[model samples]
Target: MRVQLILSEALSGLRRNASMVVSVVLVTFVSLTFVGAAMLMQMQIGKMRDYWVDRAQVAVFMCREGAATTTCTGGVANQEQLDAVREKLESPALAGIVRDIRFEDREQAYQNLLELEPDYADLVTADQLNETYWVNLVDPSQTDVIAEAFGGMDGVEEVRDQMQYLEPLFSALTVATYIAVGIAVLMLVAAVLLIATTIRLSAFARRRELGIMRLVGASNRFIQTPFILEGVFAALLGSLLAGGAVVAGMYFGVDRYLRERVPFVTTWVGMQDAWIVIPLLVVIGALLAALSAGFAIRRWLRA
Candidate 1:
């Protein structure tokens, strides 16, 4: 009987302020969606970093004939210069840092380029490609040391760390994630304020019933439960809407659009990611609604 009465009162409150309730729902929906997107972006960055960091290699490009770089003073690297570089890399000083080393000649480099960019394969010739030593490190963090050691050497034209190319892309993604989080924070604040306003108005409209109940010796919790339930109901609805939107984005936007276009990114998001995000959004919405409604009602309920 008590649960039935509380439900009826909560339903009455929602109907009495239908417009405000809808506004709260919409605001919560948008806010939680941004939160979910920001979280998924962070997860994507983690996956990409894990996938790429392990495979990142340092490329030591030896000088080729007719190269324009100042480091190519000898015009091109001969067998003696190439042997010297190999000896230095295999030296005891770099033994612990360098895990594996592979040599790629100009012809091999041209073939590899052709495989990646077949349409423009004819534009590049073997003579234009530099022989390279590919060094894989046990720890990719020591890339700078490796680069400094090989760079400016007699036969080396340039030392390029492949990981450097990925840093800017990840940094941009991280900035975008932060921006989304900021927007979500603002929207959540708006939602909380709207919830508080709605509860205050509902309390005012029902002041007479509340006054009579207080006179009859109703407890504070008994009077406040219905209003709190009203806020919780609206928030839960909004959370569901936000969860749906996030799931759609994960499926249609990230999986269908991005995965199909960029097949090379093997570590893409999936439905399981949404499972984690949905529960968190639901909890946040419930807490925001409950706290705001409870706080707003305290002053109005006082004797």
Candidate 2:
């Protein structure tokens, strides 16, 4: 009997202020959607970084043709110095740290470059190229070991690692995601405020009825339960709608679109990850709505 009464009152409250309820749902949906997108972006970035960092290699460019025995002069690598660097990299001192190493001759590098820019075929002859020792490590973090071994060494011109290139991209994406998440949080705060105002207004409009209920000795919980339920319901619906749209976009749209166009771009936050995130979004929405409604009722009712 008590449950039936609260449900009836909640439905009536929603019907009485349908416009306000709809407004609340819309705001909640937009805020939660932004938050969800930012989280998905962060997950993708983490997956990609882990993939690349683990599999990345440090390229040690060898002495090009007609280069001196000295090191790093005019961007050319020499033969004797190249051998010294290779021996040290392959030495037992670095055995566990270094997984595998491959040497790329001038012709191979030229062929790879051709694959890169087919139109720039005549940019350079094969003889003008320098061979490089591309080192794939078991541990990418042990880059300093290779650096310490090869730095200022003979025959090798320079060593470039993955961190030099990929760090900047990750940093930029992370900053952008943080900014997006920040905006979503501010919008969520605004939604909470709107909910509070709407609840306060509803309470004011029903003051006479609440007074009668109190005079009849009804518990405060009995009167406030419906309002709190209304908020929780609105939040749940809004979050579900937002989560549905995001899941659809990620699975049906973004994945297909990116795969069709940029197949090389990889992401780990797929359909499975979406399932995990949905519950979190729902919980966030529920908490926001319930807390906002409860605070408004408690404070305003005190007066």
Candidate 3:
């Protein structure tokens, strides 16, 4: 009997403030979607870091003809200078860290440059390219020490860490994730306010019935249960839709399009990740709605 009464009251409250309920649902849906997107982007960043960071190498670029670096003041690195630098890299000081070392002569470097940027291939000559020693370190975290050891050395123009090239990309994604989270937070606040407004309006519209119930010895808990349930049901519906949207994004958007296009990415988000995020979103939605309804009723529906 209590369950039926609560359900009927919740249904009546929802029907009474239909537009506000729709607003709450839509707001919660959009908010949770942002939350899901931010989470997925963070996951992608982690996967990319875990996969690619270990593959990163330190490139010790030798001086090229006409280069104007302080370390390259001796015109260009001669073959003797190049051999000396290679010997230093293979020295005992870097024994455990140096896993492999590959040399890129001017010709080979220029060819790689052309392959990377064919349109500008004819614009630059071979002498303009630097001879590079690609140093594969056992651990990527030792990149700074390697760079410091070789950067100011004779015949070396600069020591380039491959991770530098990847940092900006990951940083941009992190910023995007933060932006999504910010928007989600704002939208969630809007959802809460809308829920509170809807509950207030529902309570006001049914003031006469509540007054009769109060005269018949209805407790405050009994009166508040239906209003809280109404908000919880609406928010739950929105969260369910948001969860579905998140799963669809991961499957169709990330897995299908992104993974297929970027075949090199071995670690991609799957349904399991989506499933993990969905339940949390549902719980958050339900809590937001219930808390807002309870607060609104306590403030406005005082006997």
Candidate with better lDDT, 2 vs 3: 3
Candidate 3 residue lDDT tens string, 181-262? 9999999999999999889889989999999999999999999999999999999999999999999998899878998898
Between candidates 2 and 3, name the one with more favorable TM-score: 2
Q: Give all TM-scores, in the order shown.
A: 0.93, 0.93, 0.87
**Per-residue lDDT over 179-255 for candidate 1, one digit per residue giving the tens place of the 0 to 100 score:** 99999999999999999999999999999999999999989999999999999999999999999999999989987
Provide the overall lDDT of each model, using Cα atoms, as 2-decimal numbers.
0.93, 0.83, 0.90
Candidate 1: residue pairs that collide: none
Candidate 2 Cα errors over 4 Å, as ranges: 65-79
Candidate 3: 10-residue stretch with minimal lDDT: 262-271
Residue by residue across 1-303, what tens digits does model 2's lDDT show?
A: 999999998888888888988988999899998888888889889888988988789988776766654675645655566677778888999899889999999889989989988976877878777788889898889898787778677667667796778899989989989997998899899889988887887888788989999999998888888888888888888899989978987877677676678666665578887887888899999999999999888887688
The candidate that achieves the highest lDDT relative to the unseen native structure: 1
When superposed on Cα atoms, how far off is each prediction in RMSD? 1.9, 2.1, 2.6
Worst 10 residues of 2 by lDDT: 69-78
Clashes of 2: 4
Q: Any idea what lDDT model 3 has? A: 0.90
For each predicted model, how many residue pairs clash, with residues at least 3 apart or on different chains? Answer: 0, 4, 0
Residue 62: error of model 1 in Å?
Answer: 1.0
